[model samples]
Each structure stands twice: as C-alpha cells, then as structure tokens.
Target: MKNKVTAALIASAMLGCLGTGVYAGSNLQEIKAYLNPGIKFKVDGQPVQLTNSSGAVITPIVYDNNTYLPVRSISNLLGVTVNFDGKSNTVELGEQTEGVSIAKGFDSSYHTKDPKVTIYNGKDYKDVFFDNGSGTRGSSFMLYPEGKYQKLYIQIAAIGEDLKEFTIQDSDTDTVLKKQDVRVEDGLVTIEADISGVKALYVHGDAKSGGSVFIPLTTSYYK
Candidate 1:
C-alpha cells in the first residue's frame, strides 16, 4: 500500500509540471509578426475597385490604420497599362505619354465675341461665349478636331453663381451624348466622355440668359 501511494504522488507531480508548461503565456511579439491586416487607395478622388487573382472584385482591408490599394488598378487608373507574361512570370508596364489638349488642338466657332482664353478663377480658360438674347434662348458652339479621338475630358460651369444646363452631341449624327446641369460654386465642373467615332462635337446649353462655359481639357486615342 505504501509503494502504491508513492507512485500515485509521482504521477500527480508530473501532471502538474506538464500543465504549467502547457498553460504558459505565448510570445506576443512572435504572434504580432503574422498579423498583417492590409491599406486603402483612391483615383481622381474616387475609391479604386480591387480585383483578385481570379478576376473577382474584392474590397480593400485596413491594417494598422493605413489604407492599401491594388497596385495594378491604381497604375491603370493613372494611365499606365500593365501587362503580365504568364509563361515566364514577367510583368511589363507601358510608358505614359502626355495627353493631347483639346482646347489647343481643335478649332472652335462661337457667335459671342466675349468667349476668349483669359484668367478666370485663377486659371486660364477658353471661356464660354454668352448669349444675352431675350426669352431664354440658348447658344451653341462648334468644335472641329483635326484627328479622331476616343475620349474627351471637359470642364464646364455656369457663367454666374447659378446652375446651368449643358448638352454635348455628335454633330455628324445629331445624337446627344450627355446633358447635365452643373454649378461651379464648389469647384470647376468636370466630365470624361467616350467620344469614339465622333468627328465633331456640338456643345449647346438650355434656353438661358447667361450661357454655360465649356473648357476642353484632354483627349486620348490610340495611335
């Protein structure tokens, strides 16, 4: 009976020692190394949409209070083309060129002689031609491009402090591409439109006393 009690005590002591080692605090420094949550990204004051390797859209995650963005998406948004070679696992980024300026490259005609490139809101603008005609009559402007362009970036705003309605149309087909009423109180109004296969664009405004101003920003097309 005495030998049996001694064996039982030894077993209980071994179990206590093993339990202490098993329940010991883990190394928090080592654990923190693996905890990378993620960052955020934006383009042109807009949040960038992320896509995974399988071409599925994913949302960005925040890690350590920093925003992370997908490199490919941000690069593309900034006008850099990304190409991947799967066979050799190589990636290529195309060169970015200076975009063509629409205001300098195209010819414009307007009825009002007040429309001229001048300093407005601390920047030079080929300002809009005004139509002060009675009975809410709108004015129009014509632009003739020397070459074809796929995209057109324009900044338009009201002449006064009020909102103004403006429309863009394909002069050849007379198809309305976009129409919107914009106010310039906050900042300069801006838009990016796909003007593919369009030779000429007609900018028109709603029947109003003060005309909406149009400023051509940039044009992009393949060579």
Candidate 2:
C-alpha cells in the first residue's frame, strides 16, 4: 500500500505538479485519511472542514519533487474562493484577502545582520546563511509574518562546527517556540512548527566555534 501511494505521487511529480510538500504521515492509510472529505484544518487558529459536492476528497500530493496542496482545500481553509475551467485547463485563486507574507525563503530586508542568500545542491529555493560572530558576537533575524498560515518549515544547521545553541521565538507574543540547549550538529536540521496564529518569528543564533546556520524556510498557506 505504501509503495502504491509513493508510485502515484511520483507519477504526479513527473506530470509537473509543483508545490510545497505537506506530509501528514508516511503510510498509505494516513495519506488517504488526510484526503478524506471530512478532513479538518486550522486557519488562524480556527477549525474548518472541507467538503466536496461529488463526495470526493481532495489531497496534497508530491509532484515535481514538491508537495502540492489541493487548490480547493487550501482555498476553503484560507477563506479564498477558487475557480477552475476544465475547458482551458486553468485554475484561478482569489487574491489574498488577509495580509500575509508567505514565501520559500527570507529576503535580505528581513535579516538583521545581512545573511547571504545562497542555493545548495539539490535544493530548489534560496536559503539564508548566518554566521555566529566571533569573540562574543551574535546574529539574528527578525521576521514579521502577518495574517494566517498553516506551517513554518525551517532547515537550519551548522556549517563545519556544531552550533552550541539557537532559539526560535514568536516575537509578537513573546513566546519561545524552540530553544536548543544541545548542539545543532553538522548537516541539515529541519524543524516544522505550527504557525497558524503567529504574528512574528525571531531566530537567534549562538555558537562557540562560530559556524553558519542555514534557514530554508517554506511557509504554507491557503489561496
């Protein structure tokens, strides 16, 4: 069953369905459950369910090596309308009604110390790289994401040396989302958080050996 599901998604990828990947589970049953017509979602901390007129469920699938959320499902969750014209094979999403900034990575203006935006091998979007200053120096990024979003996916890691400590926080609410006491080892360390009602995100980096941290953030949202 798992193999079947993986094959189906891989096929979709071949057909050029591209978007962010939203994995609820790894098994086929879980994937199916995620697609159930009665599946519930949270938008700005509000619960909402999706329904189809034909009794079919909409699901997110891996396409073009990315997870593509169902247009209908995301639209309903974000309170945006969707229109599809089968004749022209076109899908239209309504303009964003709410003020939200959703993107694959952070822009230069959002960084505090001017982190370099670079691309890694086998990665699609650009990622920010921050170096912990030497001799009692530190760096941080202050990100203000207004409006609603489902998740915040971040890939952070140390360059050569392990990161002694790091912190992720919701600056608007003054709530710390994650604070790592142990070292963030070399290689990619991905973290996903539910940022539904979060107004702002702050990332602080501290290291003993002065290493770099990669932040390839991908924010999910409705239309």
Q: Which stretches of candidate 1 lie over 4 Å from their true place?
A: 1-96, 105-117, 126-135, 161-163, 210-223
Q: Show how many residue pairs clash in every candidate, following the order shown.
A: 4, 3
* Error in Å for residue 55 of model 2: 37
- On residues 1-223, what C-alpha lDDT tens digit does candidate 1 reach at each position? 1232233333333221111112334432421212233444454567765554356664543345543444344333443333344444433333213345554544445322243544356655443433434455565676654223445666655555444557778898898877777665745666655554466888777655443454433322221
TM-score of each: 0.43, 0.43
Q: lDDT of candidate 2 vs native?
A: 0.48
lDDT of 2 by residue, 16-98 (tens): 22122323333324232222233345545677554343445545445334544555445444433344444455444443233
Error of 2 at 220 (Å): 10
Question: For candidate 2, what is the TM-score?
Answer: 0.43
How far is 180's C-alpha from truth in model 1 (Å)? 0.9
Model 2 stretches with alpha carbons more than 4 Å out:
1-127, 181-186, 217-223
